[model samples]
Target: MQMNGMNIKPVTVILLVLLLVGFYYYYYYYYYLSQYRFNVPPCPTSCSTSEPKDRVPDVIPTDYVFHLKTPDHLQYSQPSIVKGRTDVVAVTPWLAPIVWEGTFNPVLLDSIYKQKKINIAVTVFAVGKYIMFLKNFLETAEKHFFVSFNVHIYVFTDRPKEVPKVNMAPGRQLTVRSVPSSNRWQEISARRMELIQKLIEEQLRKHSDYIFCLDVDSQFHSRWGTESLGGLVAVIHPGYYLDDRGKFPYERRPESRAYVAHGEGDFYYCGGAFGGLLQEVFLLANTCRSNFEEDAKNGIEAAWQEESHLNRYMWINKPSKVLSPEYLWQDFKPRNPEVKTIRFSGVIKNYAAIRPNV
Candidate 1:
């Protein structure tokens, strides 16, 4: 093409054509092509630096996914050839294989996971009189809680000096963090999630592989060990495990995000004791903390506070394992025969006196 009687060079026209082509290819390869076809790895220091080996699926299904792994050569419902227990059953489907005493071989599991030196982060808060329960809790934990696996009991309390110095066994430790004292038990319970989220992000995530958020006013009585480890674990609340799912005390307020309609819960998990992989526990704690904050801002606290939020999250996320009521028995209730072991029990408390402005 000619402009103002000036002859345009064929080389100039070719160069312009080449520049346009270059721009088109660059845009396609860098922006459009990579997003549609490539799995771009994160750069160092941004987050996860590892490159993905497989192409990520385009669409992830919304339905719950459960993965169960049993010990060698034992049928799901059949009698255990090694232990000769005929009552073994696969409860909770893929969410969590119910961990009973006869269902697992402690020695065999220890030999396998011990090499990993699994660092368990057990977090609990003792505000007010709840501090008194720490001694028995720590002593019993040393005796039964992941005895073979490396364990660190992180006690969050207003009085660090009050935290008992229970003799720790090999591969065990106790850490006390000073938290603000609270008059109300409900306030203390709700704040535990926020404190845990902060700890996991600042410290626990770096040092611990697994994290357990447990109520401080409880003591271990039997083996609570490696068999409970999973991507995420939730314990069945002893009071409501056998009750109809319709009766679960999930948040009933429609405006709250924690609301769960009747007949929706898989299990009524005790907010007092729950845990999982460090990352997953971090997510659970952070999410529950945020949910609690939102509820507070709206001037409507859920009946059970963080516990309500937990049930909502578990319904959507579906924990990898669902621990039976045996994991959290109460001293007040008669021991059910079905509960082969009472690994931990809630100590009797003066709820009226301990609670503030009740």
Candidate 2:
């Protein structure tokens, strides 16, 4: 075992060498050997699949959108016109329901939506260091968001290589689209509407029935299932839903296209999460993208970027269903008495570190 001052074991030396050799081959197989077998090309800095030739109209029948003509009794609770949540205002002045827990029966809603066999498409952006949040966002989604539905997740990110490989359920799939990186966070945030509009126009319109655009740095904590489905859905921002319209942080400048005249706005909807029937969301995204571009032409930016534009758009075109603060609660905020559950929430993040610019 010891020769002079040096202790040595032939069996130990042999085992250590074998371990290093095993690791080398393991890495080689996955890193190089696998690629060689498949004849794969190197990924580009910004890569994208070629555009499809055929494009289709973005439309869905309005009739029977909520109800089935010939109904099947799925057997849930009795009708609750007067026996629901009394603490919170359940419906907006425009008659759009503000969805909170206990307001709707999930079983009944899921059953109806299941019958349609509709496809739900979700788009999330993870450019720059925001790619770090994709794993939890996607993993939590598989657990809570539309668990049994036909779902497609379109991830738009500059760092496609960093996109996490989440094993989705049978009816769910993920698509990654590479976008050029940006230096300004405002540019990345504002350009989301443009990218979503193009996504719908180019690909989603053909097979997708609905689409939800969500922020990447968020996770689903509860059911954001078929119950939230509608023609146009907007989540009431958790930060300012309880505040007055004057303090609501709308774009106040008349020069900006996103400007909302004083006393001429509804609920402050979040830009982080919004969606609807394919055509409805297409129209919303298109309008916001155009207005944002027009404002750029005039050399003015809104106070809150795309969020301001979204508020202005929602003023003229009311959201068909408004989700409460429960839908998009902030991780930093304490749970309010009215919020029975947090469905989908933005995770607390250091903006300076993750964002390209703060």
Candidate 3:
């Protein structure tokens, strides 16, 4: 209708209102209902709550003492047997690198290739303590990567039964290897060295081509598939310090071989989530012994924790590929623009309610 010098359309007004209503509904459905949000509780300052006291004891004694040998003494070997044929083999080696040069050759490609499978191995202690986080980790991993390709999760847990049964993809498999529990979670990485060594010797000798060692306390939030694979990949540590290396917290000791050798490096990487060619990891795992022992002597069980040792090894022996910080991230801080994805998010939870006192 024409009124005065302007034209008014009743149909246009009605159409605009409908469009606004439709947009609101669409936003609400996708933003809130479709996505899964985890509500992380705040951590307490003091150790009074169920939180485990950070008792940095003078030194914890161990029955077993490890000695580092020269490169000549160390063996450069190959996989003893090849059980299954796979496009890419993944493994997390703590110790004992079975020779596998004959089984698979380390190929450096100019561009990324299609990955048929990804294998992840985690060294777990009391499953009951971090069961919730482990469950979430497995579920998130499957959602982000396993759905698209064949993925196998191998967990070396002290208590396998405590691990819940979650749905996995068609080619997905979860293998649980029994381990011993430790008084401190930090010590698990060190104490389980023997267990991991044995497992690699027996099971992972020639099973996987690529391997990732992950902490059970982390969860997956982004796409972490074959694209992240290479000769050696280390994620930027969420707790890395840009200033003086001394200011950097965690189990960093300058006198230690890992830190002392690489005194002037750009950044320190976290061992929570790391991947590499099976041969490279096996070599490092078998050779990097001095740093691990030095950290143990100072009453440091896991020595810079595991990541510290890994950083030192990488410093001395630079890997072919160095991944960005997005690979394995922690929930201690907010996200950064440079971060493409986070392999693990440490959701704060009630520790006392979950884990009992040792």
Candidate 4:
């Protein structure tokens, strides 16, 4: 074909038109469809015009009975079984069919035996300055807990070399895992969850149990390990909303698998300090990946960081135990008389103290 003394191939023109059309369709499906896909679910009619259905039964049945037992009475005391085998029992029923068990023995039955070794994992950005606070917190935690309870601190950081070299207690251990740095704290937190999942899969030995994911900036007080083992435990966020009516960092959209819309219930949870059997951590890690992936496609960074995702997961999957705020005391407010110790005291020098400037 000839156009203005220049020859144009008919096939080329057709190909260009088709390419443009394909590009248009791709955007429509990825952008437009994504919006519709993530739209929030409608509020319940009871919440507005009618009463919501009774989620719990008003009358108790004779056959329905609740029994509380000590950790010794439990079926399994290990985190998980080997990946493919089913013979292993879970430390808690919530973490079914334990795949593998960690070496950290439970100190549940006797206070004297309660000093068993425990492994704690932390995800940090450039928390170099905060290292002292963490060390102080751990030191305090050791003094309050059973003297025999050993702690192996696993620090997942972006700048491994920059992490402050601190002296740990005799039973305390520290290991750092490296990650890519990000300016957005929320993005960093979300990616840290992913990094934790990877470490559990690769670095963590099969014999390890009781994995804890903690914020690098937070400190651990005396009440850190008083609770029983083999179950999921979370500290109350001093920032937690008393009622669902109040606006919370909790993710509320239905399109988001992490949505928490029930205004009358307690679904939101703080992620500052959380620990459970190894199998449970694996499950939680898997859930975090799904929620984070969904949020990423929508251009929404991890809502309120990874805590929001954790809150959503805990809501649907009730933890074995719900701990009071004493576990992870954020440094935001003055300490209460009853509070034993503060975790991430905001008084820390600066981000440079613990984290790298980069």
Candidate 5:
């Protein structure tokens, strides 16, 4: 009601007071006292009172490794037959199932993960010229990679403004994170471990059930379904998977943080793409980042930088699922008969020009 030159109403004043009281009650109950709501439940068993460590551990624990033991019923259809046994398919000594096409049915595999209602997070760092590959990479990924499931593509880029727009499908999303660019490809590559370490600790661990670290310079060409899922998974490098262990270019310097003996190599896993459960991925990122930092401190870089450290870590702590080269094929190589499906292929690039300080 206006008192200067208009009529004042008692009913209007009462209504205004009632509305203010209602808003006050709503804010107090919903915002201030929300924790005591009847629908709120207690924290899960895994919740801990101790604060999370702010820094990476000096020594990574290797006394006990996380292993994925498949039940007898869930074993591969064709078991590795030894010495004339008909129903045997060779598996790694560590029980890390080697995945290839025709070894497992995609339908059933997707169904299992669907039942868990898991959300998968894929992280790819696009820097410098690599940013040009995002259009095709993201579009193809939307069509092929875990098409029926919930997937979040986390694209870390130096030029966030230049990130191209791609139409995302239902139950899928893209997040562009701004990261500082580097002149050297080695620095850009090695920094992934550190960035991912922080991302997992600060953000990803709370949202995604599983996490996949991927190379942006690759494209998905076939179905990269839930068959690749496990507690911890690593893909064999297409270039060195067949190479003899003795000749594998593992870090040989004892002073380097990523040192591995000449003859002590499993399948040379690629650094292009790897994934696992959120917690396990966090451990991997943490370990790799810490190792990379230590190597930097000694003024020594591993032979292949982050990849070298990844190989060393996976060797000491075996991957639960070792994907065949089908998971990561290179366009430079001729398609092999054994590679039933090339889920993702790395495109050729002018490395000397793209990489600084070459």
Candidate 6:
């Protein structure tokens, strides 16, 4: 321990050993440990923050993790189990609320979430000539969709250059993430779950409280605020909410991952719009994406692409909130008396004209 020194005490050697150990740790922390902890690969110049550029290896397993939290000072009507919407079923068999016009108090719910500074992420796809719908989709959104709240719209399209610029509200933003153009609209629909799963794992879990995956071909006609937020949310397919489950357009093929046996599905949920707590939608997107790919490998495409898979998944994992057909009425359909308001509805499209392939 003394080396060439004339006199070296045991304490001196011990102190020197301690100092060496400290230096070793300092070097490891600066050169290796810290890098491992904090360094992320430099993002390619081709893909910036607005675009989803990376896939996470350690994607958190989506599990049940949601509990409603409404802060104090939320003044609303007292609940009466018997006084709710009696015309249309207001609650699911499992007790999840069917969101009709009168079932939720928008003012009180918005105030509760506003106080918490909730951020809602909306994902919409407008590829090919579908981009034309982006204009009214966003403009109407500013007017009726989560107004006065922090709304971030993520529009995925192959044609980023053509993304329309509707003036955003103070707390709202529009992001364009380039996606490949698909010849088949069904392929595009299936790919949505893949991209959505990636988006949630890459960013939404940290930055967003909730997410709404909507159809770009649709427009907002009435308020779509906090009343629709929940752990797992599904809007009833306007076409089939009144129809029996036996007639639902679910994938009946046993070979397909989306197969729903007769009399099993609770409701046929529209693929056009469904969302919830970031984690909940993450589960839906991840599961649907996996199932869709599995089915593709076996040469079995569901009847309605992702929509069929969504109904299958929702059947097994019931939605916590079921929005009535009012949430997504088709403009082509005659308005039902039960649809108090068309919060969002799909505009009739000339599919042959806009789609890449008819």
For each candidate, the alpha-carbon lDDT, in order, equals 0.76, 0.84, 0.53, 0.53, 0.77, 0.83
Q: Residue 266 of model 5: what lDDT?
A: 83
- Tens digit per residue, CA lDDT, model 5, 247-296: 78889997886888776878788998999876667667777877788779
Off by over 4 Å in 1: 1-89
- Give lDDT tens digits, candidate 4, residues 24-136: 99999776555322222232432221211212111211221122234444454555544432332233344422212222233443332342333444333334344445555
Alpha-carbon runs more than 4 Å astray in model 3: 1-112, 115-128, 192-194, 241-246, 249-255, 261-263, 294-303, 340-343, 350-358
**What TM-score would every model get versus the actual structure?**
0.77, 0.83, 0.60, 0.60, 0.76, 0.80
- Report the lDDT tens digits of candidate 3 across residue range 68-149: 1223233344444655334222332332121111222322110123232334444443354765567877787778753445
Clashing pairs in 2: none
Let me know the TM-score candidate 6 reaches against the reference structure.
0.80
Q: Which candidate number maximizes lDDT? A: 2
On lDDT, the stronger of 2 and 5 is 2
Model 2 TM-score (2 dp): 0.83
lDDT of 3: 0.53
Candidates' RMSD to native: 9.2, 20.9, 25.9, 16.9, 13.2, 8.7
Per-residue lDDT over 105-132 for candidate 2, one digit per residue giving the tens place of the 0 to 100 score: 8887777778888899999999999999
For model 1 the local lDDT of residue 290 reads 75
Better of 2 and 4 by TM-score: 2
Candidate 3 contains a number of clashing pairs equal to 14
Error of 3 at 198 (Å): 3.2
Indicate the worst ten consecutive residues by lDDT in candidate 3.
56-65
For model 2, the superposed segments whose C-alpha errors exceed 4 Å read 1-58, 64-66, 69-71
Off by over 4 Å in 4: 1-147, 226-228, 241-245, 262-267, 336-358
lDDT of 1 by residue, 143-246 (tens): 88898678888888888877777788887888888989876677888898889878876777457778888887898989898888876799989999777988
- Model 3 reaches what TM-score against the true structure? 0.60
Better of 2 and 4 by lDDT: 2
Per TM-score, what order, best first? 2, 6, 1, 5, 4, 3
Query: In model 4, how many backbone clashes occur?
Result: 27
Please give the distance, in angstroms, between residue 267's alpha carbon in candidate 3 and its true position after superposition: 1.5
By TM-score, the best candidate is 2
